[model samples]
Target: MKISNQNKTLDLTYPQVMGILNVTPDSFSDGGRFNHIDAALKQARAMIRDGATIIDIGGESTRPGAAQVSEEQEIARVIPIIEAIRLESDVWISIDTSKPQVMKRAVAAGADLINDVRALTVDGALDVAAQAGVPVCIMHMQGQPQDMQDNPQYCDVIDEVADFLNERIAQCIKAGIKRENIVLDPGFGFGKTMAHNFRLINQFNRFLDFKLPVLAGLSRKSMFDHLLSLKVDERLASSLTGALLCAQQGAHILRVHDVKETADMLKIMNTVASATH
Candidate 1:
């Protein structure tokens, strides 16, 4: 599959890495890491050198219980970084926001994709993405980030998530977003228990039936901590494990924090997978 964006189509011939760049002081996972333009530009180049095909920039912290940022604040934080990355490099850029206004401004500043955690349903979000003309990654979350994990439950987690993604994809199509510009995410760690996340990871390839590339954003997620009994700062090993597992499960894209490690793992796995075939 290929993601159509800005007169270019990103061919999904192998597992692609999307380095995470959060311009926030409260990203829950990597807060205060790259809030400045100089630091962010350096990190973005390093990821690209280390083999990241995409740079996903976000200003808001969608981590569980994160307070929302105003539209102006969100745009203020992310757009400049997006523009800086574009000015420095041409790596595919994904704006990780759900707000319609932010989406509009980010795209205008040169974002190649819209990674909407809300699946582009926030007030004017769908319309903004439709007008932006970029690849849209629709993700499934049980509720808003502020309370998503408060009591996330599912009688059948995988089926329900697939259903939600399917419906969201249909909605985007109905809203005039091209099918080739669509991707689906199971939303690991968004609003799921460890069991739910494990099941989704184990069965992620089932989503291929939707005919869109699958992206797995499980880096440093709580599931790794719950399974490995590690602190957030100590979960690198588990995060790499999940990234590798997701790639083996046929994930077309991996949204990750540790890009070099995941990129090295993908090099070996892709070589092995190809050799065997």
Candidate 2:
């Protein structure tokens, strides 16, 4: 599928890496590392140099039990970085936010996509995305970020998530956004137990029923931490493996912190896969 974004069609058949740039002090993975405008722009340029096709800029910490960031704070944290990156590079930019206000202003600052963890379910979010006319990633989170991780359950995790994405895509189309401008994410860590997350990650390919682009964000999640029994710094290998599996399962985008390695690995893997086919 070709995802329409920023007046261009994004090639979604081959998987690409979206380097994560969190301009927050408390993201679950790499927080405070890129909060400064210069630092964030440097990281974005480096990711693009390493073959990152998209740079995902996030201000709020969606980590479990984290307090919500006000719209003012969110915009303050992201707008400068978005502006700085646009001036320094031409890589696609995705504002990782759920607030309609932030989404609106970030696009004005030159963001090409909206990577909302709430999947545009927040109030006025649909209107902001529809008006901006950029691709919006709709992820399936079980509940609010504050308490999503506590006692999460689903009758059938994959099917439930897939159904939720299908409905959200249809909702976007009805709201005047084109289908080609929508991407679906299974929301790996948003509100699931390790087992549930694994179940979804292991079988995410089944979500192809929607036929829209899929973004897999399993980079450095708690599932890898739990399985590897490693500290946050030691999960790089596992993260790469998960990224590879996500690509093999039809993920068009692998959102990650380790962009250089993921890009190199995808190159080798793609070459081998093509040879076999």
Candidate 3:
């Protein structure tokens, strides 16, 4: 499968690595690390050189209990970096945001995709995304980020997530967004308990029923921290394992922090699978 905008295209026939570039000062893992223009560009180029097909740029910290930033602040934080990246590279860029204005402005600046954790439920978000004319990734979150992790309950985690994504897909289509331009994420750590997270990963194939590309954003999530008693920096091994498992389950995109390691793992897996086939 291929996701394209006028400026760039990502071929997902093989697994694709989407490097995470959080331009915020409070993101869970890499906050304050690339909040500068020079650092951000350097990291973006490094990820591209390390085999990343897409660079996901986020201006807000969506970590649980995270506060929100205004549209103007978000635009200020990301637009310059987006512009700088475009001047030098043509790699696909994804704007990770939930605001309609951010979606529109980021696309104008050079973003090729919208990766909204709120699934465009925020007012005006659906309209802007439909009109942006780019690929959109709608993720499922049980509640607002502030209190989502307090008490995440579901009768059946996988079925509920699938139902929510399917409903959002219908809403996007009804809003005039083409089905082919849509992608789905089960949202591994967003408002999910440890059990819920594992169930989704183990049963991730259930999401293929939608017949759209699946994106797994499991890098440095709290599940590994809680399960393995490891800190964020120590979760690379766990993160790579989750990413490889997601690829094995047919996930098309892996939104990750360790771009080089994930890409190398995918390369080896593809090589063996090809040799067998």
Clashing pairs for model 3 are none
Error of 3 at 83 (Å): 0.4
Q: Best TM-score goes to which candidate?
A: 3
Error of 2 at 113 (Å): 0.3
Residue ranges of candidate 2 with Cα displaced over 4 Å: none
Q: lDDT tens digits, residues 1-277, model 3?
A: 7777766677888989999999999999999999999999999999999999899999999999999999999999999999999899889999999999999999999999999999999999999998998999999999988989998999999999999999999999999888988989999999999999999989988888888899999999999988999999999999999998889999999999999999999999999889965
Q: Tell me the lDDT of model 1 at 235.
A: 79
Q: How many residue pairs clash in each candidate?
A: 0, 0, 0
lDDT of candidate model 2 versus the reference: 0.90
Model 1, 1-277: lDDT tens per residue? 7888766778898989999999999987889989998898899999999999999999999999999989999998998899888887889999999999999999999999999999998998988899998989999999899899987999999899999998998899999999978999999988899999999989988888888899999888888778778788787888888888788878999999999999999999978877964
Off by over 4 Å in 3: none
What does the lDDT read for residue 219 in candidate 2?
86
* Residue-level lDDT tens digits of model 2 in 1-277: 7777656666877897899999999998888898888888888989999999899999999999988889999999999999998887778999999999999999999999999899899889998899999999999999898899889999999888988888898889988899978888999988889999889878988987677888999888888778878888888898898888888889999999999999999999889988965
Worst 10 residues of 2 by lDDT: 1-10
**Cα lDDT listed for each candidate:** 0.90, 0.90, 0.94
